[model samples]
Target chain A: MADTDSSQRVQEILTQATEELKSIKVPNDDQLEYDLGNLLVSNNNTLDETLTRDPEKIDSYLHNLARDSIQALLNRVWELPSERIDSDIYATLPKPTTRLPREKPVPKPRPPTKWEKYAREKGINNRKKDKKVWDDVLKRWVPRFGYRKIAAEKEKNWVKEVPSNADPFEDQFAKAAEMKKENVAKNEFQRLRNIAKNKKIKVPSVGVTGNEYASKNELSMAMHHAKHATASRGKFQPELPNEKKVKGLGKKRKIEFTTGSGQVEKKRNIEVLEKMDKPSLNLDGAIHKEIRDENVAMDLKRKGGKVYGRRSKMGGRHRTKSDHKSLKLGTGFQGKGKGKGKGKGKPKGKPNVGAKKKIGGPKMQGKGRPAGKGKMKGKGKGK
Target chain B: MRPLKNEETVLVFTKLKKYIGSNVRALLERSDGLYCFRLHNGRIYYVKEDIMKFAATLPRDNIVSLGVCFGKITKGGKFLLHITALDFLHPYCQNKIWIKESAEQNFMYGNHVYKSGLSRISENTPKYAGVVVLSSKDIPLGFGVAAKATAECRHADPMDIICFHQADIGEYVRNEEALI
Candidate 1:
């Protein structure tokens, strides 16, 4: 029993020596500063010469110093707050005192749109409106815009009273609907214009003023052309401040030349070739001829001159018997009045028909008369 | 290398279609992989998609050429088919003309094939249609447009032109500087 008691005392003494060795003690203990929130501790206390100088004891001594620092930090963290997260106890960390450098600079504010600028100038504060509004007729809330909204109210009416100035047969309902459509289109156009203005894109002119030569558009266009006249195509030219990216204002057209998968290109090529292969006749000459004929007819009527006859303008000669008789009588009278007039004019009037029929072969057979064999023979005998 | 512009694509495709007819589509999209046409220094290269993507990363100056050089677009906007395109053209050519052994050297000299040199012509070959000119042993020497229809060739004089020479393999040496 005495031996066992003695062995227990020896074991207790060994454990006490090890415990003493594990506990680190440094001079000026209060000088050690720590930030528990950052889990950092700064130990400015002088190190013990015995532990640091001995290579074998250096690791354990340094480890004991770290453990003591960590324990103090944990104890300070535990005193602050505790929370249950996902059924696990967690000590809430305080806000870090250290100011870290930013990864990127603060972003610039977005430029105001045209409408926003206008609103600001007018001292208008934007207020959010409710999406749904109460409808009296339906007795239920409906959206302000889109999806069962009370839009185009005028068009929704089944019957509309026409004004006295309006035609009685006119569809007033359709007219109302068209007006509403025009209004919507105008609003949409204005919205798009505002967006384009904000984006620095030049809007197309609504109309050309009479004094366009002196207009801003003309000046800008001239300047644009002059700038592009350079060898570098205005690339090296000096730029004006606050310049809007208007198309044709020293900007080359961004041609999205269809890159070759070759499908679209092939289709386009085939279409072009097909169009080229197709026989497209130009009927402009024919149309001009008709216009000319109409103008000539109108001129003759205006002058109070009788129209010679119904002339076939499309090359087909559609002469009546009366026309031929008139021609023959007029030519015969003219020939008697002027000696060689009949010889020149008679053939012009009759040869096309008479020569084709082979009836008026010889001048002695007939002159300025219809080509008939029996009539010609009888006329010859009588002569 | 960059994807060909519409005009350049159309120009290349049209020239390719002249020889292969509608089979130009087969060249565009093949069973092996999707192939695309790219333009590099006026030369149109028919490259596979993956190789094209890889080549795109390379500096333009470093790359001499890629894939098959089908042809080049001249400054005058005319597409000139190179003899390098003969490999793709021979398989899909719609019509073919074969010449006799004695006149093979004459054709190589870039002269138009005469009726006396014509050994066998493809049946129903249309007049002015693109045809592959082959030797008597069935080797494609070059390509050209048929000067006369198959039916008109029977009565044509020996001195009469049978095939108008467009391009020949002999151009590889003679017109070496101009070729890609």
Candidate 2:
């Protein structure tokens, strides 16, 4: 009778669990089955076989079972005495130790040698003495036993030593010096010759002359004359006389000087003056005749006659108003106007027709107004 | 390894104490200006200017996001690196983190980042790179990889490889706790 009552109670619990599972939604489709399978596997036979057909019912059953089982297991473990369990584990463990193997004493790290100590302190090993050498080519002190040593040595010894006496350098030097001196002299001579040629003076021939002193003097004089001639070539004035005059002497001294050689009385034949006499002027007729001749010559020249003063046919004194109007009897006078015929008797006083009037009085003469004052009622207004 | 404290100042101070010596003390302490830590011993062996510069160059918050370590690569070559500073760089360096190229690039990149006033390191070298510190004999002492190299390793400490690599087991691990 008790087993029947327990079975009915389990059935009632499973029914409530199925209702709870149906209420809860599965979060993911793919893992839902796996989750439900895991729940059923843990519960095994504790759930009713009908719950397997419906996963939702099985889920609730497994969930409650897991919670109750976990709690029961935890309670059982907690009931055990802590000290008893610790002792049991301790007893099974290996023994503890305070010391370890000495580790071979670390091979007793060898005490650093003197050099090693120095190197450690200084941070590098000292270089060897034989390794340092002066590199003449590089002009520096460098390691002698390195890759550049051979090249350095070769550069250092590239110049071979020659015996002093075996060299002909002295003779060569002397020859060069002599040549240089000759070249300098030649240059100087050429320069002087150029200067002479530029001055238009002839260069002296390059040879010894028997009259060396005379020739030198002559040459100097010639050069002086050439310079003087060149200086005065375009000038035309004579030098002033250098004689000095004696001032304020007596008349007797003057008379004595004059009588000494200037007043010699030697008689000689005197020459007579000759004159050619002719008639004087026949006044009236001669005056008229001369006037007629001048008029005739002037008229001829004006008529384009070949006269002495008519070389340039267009010659005349600039025309005054009277000269412009003076009409020649046979020549036509085309005066400046609209007609070929003569204009009204050559207008007088500059033919004042188009002449600009002189701009002097009233209109242009008045000061309009005083500056800084209004246009009307000023002191100089209309004056 | 024990997780490092997040505070930059405390971490720097602790590193200074650990590597320089426990006897060292903070000589001039100022986070705003320049901070100096000195050894209390009479010799007063102190952290160098370069170390302070390196510390100042670090990103304020993320310094411990990556582990860092310092030691003399040789007698004169001192180095500092994030445990992950060279993880990506190691393959290119033939897997030897202490080699000259690695050390030099680490220092050079560190200095470049510092000079640029960048909180983050650069990535590509030979272009946006820094110079490496070399010994008198031209051996690399330390390098500075751009902060980008560390970032590429998911911000892992470069020195962590040296600490956790299998071959480093006997040499680096003092105990089982060290492996953790």
Highest-scoring model, TM-score? 1
For model 1, residues A148-225, the per-residue Cα lDDT tens digits are 664534234546789999999999878877998999997898788777876778655433322344466656665676
Model 1's alpha-carbon lDDT is 0.70
DockQ values of all predictions: 0.07, 0.01
Number of clashes recorded per candidate: 0, 22
Residue pairs with colliding backbones in model 1 are none
Interface RMSD of each: 4.8, 71.4
lDDT of candidate 2 over A111-157, digit per residue (tens): 55444667899899666577677765678886667787766766666
CA RMSD, predictions in order:
25.1, 50.9
TM-score of chain B of 1: 0.92
